[model samples]
Target: MTLTQHAAPPEPPAVAAESVPGPARRRPPRRGPGLLLRPVFLGVVALVMLVPLYVLVVNAFKSQQEILTDPFGLPDGGPTFQYLDRVFHNAQFDIMRGYAVTILFVVCVNVLSVVLAGPAAYVIARSTRRRYRALMVFFLAGTFIPSQVLVIPVVYVLKVLGLMGTVRGFVLFETVLTLPFSIFLYAGYIATIPRELDQAAAVDGAGRVRTFWQIVFPLMRPVVATMVILNTFSVWNDFVNPQIILGPGSGLYTVTTGVYAAVSQFSTDYTVVFPTLLLAIAPLLVFFVFMQRHIISGLTAGSTRG
Candidate 1:
């Protein structure tokens, strides 16, 4: 009979409704002085770099009156193409012609330099002999010598050879000036490439010329592209060399010299000067835009290989 009060079936084991541990608290968004300062630093840097380009573009569109009145302001109305028109029509025609000559110079120099330097670089990289090493060091040391320092000597030599004032003369000078660096860069890159590739080619009956042209040359496209772009820009923009060697009214002015001549002659004539400047820069801009991918690729290739 038990005074067993029917214990109510122990309340169903207390169901725990909540998780044993509360939900993880998200970390407070990190805030530090660096985070605040970074954007400001970047903005300042961007502003500093952009100011000159902004001024150039704006001044190109402005009349002399506008430029003098408000050097830093936006155009009073819409931008005008008058300066551009004048430049295209008259101010820079000769300069544009010079640009064409520069293009020719660049192409020739790049092709010749690459052809000569490629083999030299390959040999220097693969050779273990002390004599070849000494030669490589000599070649590299030449790069430290300033071209300007040699100008007088070069002119004298060219004069002796009766090659002055000729395109061929300029080509020869540039080739010599540019070759050392090209060879150095190529050698560094070639050193990183496995010699086994060359050995394999030779084993398969590929001659040196054939192996280089078919195998090595293809692999070097990025470096070649970089060399072309660099040499092209240098040759195109070269003012002092062309100015001194080509002389005035030689009809052989490069764009840089042409623009300089325009500026000197016109002085404050913005209509002429702006357009000339614009035209002078236009080719470089176009080239950079078009070849940017290749340039970037070449840079990456050289960096990684070296």
Candidate 2:
């Protein structure tokens, strides 16, 4: 043996514990001026958005004297319910009734639009034919047509059908006005659903109607919730339609019309008018508070898909 016997196999290179695969390396902490600006920016936005609402509520509770003398001051005198009382008693109960009518109109429009548009949307989404695409475009185009332009023709047709000045007539018009947008939204959302779901249902011997009701309709709940919130808000707040179609004497007045009427009657009385305006908006505020989560969820979900 050539006494060159490997020098004891050179004690295997010492394995340093720290050099072994230990926990992952941590990234250095981020530092920048932008990080400090985020909260400040959000606070500014929040303050900007809250100013008008704060003024509305504060002014609503103040007396006409207080409003004129110190528009921005907190009530120096004890807050009085006089304005609300006047709104309730002197406004001919129209405010209350108008709220009822608005609720009815919103519910009717929401149901009718969803029921009618859902199927149409489903068909457009599933159909491969060029005609369906054309129809979808036609529906979307209708939204661009001003309601003012159509008012004359709509009134003429309603008069011929003896539906003018009637709540039913208003409901019908709202349904028609909202339908195009509803169908467009639903169709866009439905397009994102996998066709295999429908096919799978079909393979199980489910017919079109069954497949739609059991499978597709349930999936559309989020979009439907969003549409209901949007449509209800629009129809409830609409002024021009009810003002023109319902006419002055008709009891078919909605909250918007009633508030306008109150404004006309109490033009000089800030106490009366402001309270009435507050009352008119209260329902919408309450509704938004309760349904905001659903509306946001629905919109976000729909956007991700379609």
Candidate 3:
């Protein structure tokens, strides 16, 4: 009978509850519903944000009659590009020139901003001097002031310099308008990086310029991408600045100002204007979508690290 010798009670499995050094507790299984809520919430939010966009897209392809008759509905006649044609072909607004000026203006502003701010931010971040605080305050204060307040002064200065309504003027003004914020962003982000990197670069033959270009600049990619997106959007869609600087009926109109050309005191061309607005925003939307991944990291970089 004993030949079926009690197999020694199976030694407790290595990670058995009783074998655990402390009171053993099991984690509740993550609930599927709770896990699913985030995507569901985001999807709902995305749909909500897209309602206006849906209206624009639907109305852009339709006629004035369709827009008035079924404002909330999709295009009855499919996408009609006549409005686009009219918007671009209108004699009052030089749409092609506007596009050219806009591209040039955006490029120059981004170039000047990155080139100037990169070094300035590096210096400000790495500086130990007490006066740097004042400098930082000066730059960041520009962000708080409404641009309208400076309109008269900006116009006067540009007028004196013979830069008014010129692409050069737009580039200079946009760069100045944006620099403070760009420097502020770059400075905050650069501070999080350790000095060890700079030192390592210095230990080699790398000087300040080389160190910054080779070592520091590469790490600033996320922040730079963020700046590029922001500066491009601001310069591209600028209405008030272009209006004030370029003056009435200026050939230097951008896509934004071109949209304004569609409006009059007595009536507005909703069909053409709406399509033009869509065209104006299309580049911004596409850029944001493509660069969306970099945005989160870039925005957070200043607060993270060290």
> How do the residues 89-167 of candidate 1 rate in per-residue lDDT, one tens digit apiece?
5643566576688788888888889889888988888889999889889999999998888888989898899888888
- Of models 1 and 2, which has the larger lDDT? 2
Return the lDDT, model 3, position 149. Answer: 88
The residue pairs that clash in candidate 2, if any, are: none
Clashes by residue pair, model 1: none
The numbered model that scores best in lDDT is 2
In model 2, which range of ten residues has the least summed lDDT? Answer: 1-10
The residue-level lDDT of candidate 2 at 182 comes to: 90
TM-score of 3: 0.82
**Which is better, 2 or 3, measured by lDDT?**
2
RMSD of each: 4.5, 4.1, 5.0
TM-score of every candidate relative to the true structure? 0.83, 0.86, 0.82
Ranking by TM-score: 2, 1, 3
1 versus 3: better TM-score goes to? 1
Clashes of each: 0, 0, 0
Give candidate 2 misplaced runs (Cα > 4 Å). Answer: 1-41, 303-306
lDDT of each: 0.81, 0.87, 0.82
Query: What is the lDDT, from 0 to 100, of the residue 106 in candidate 3?
Result: 84
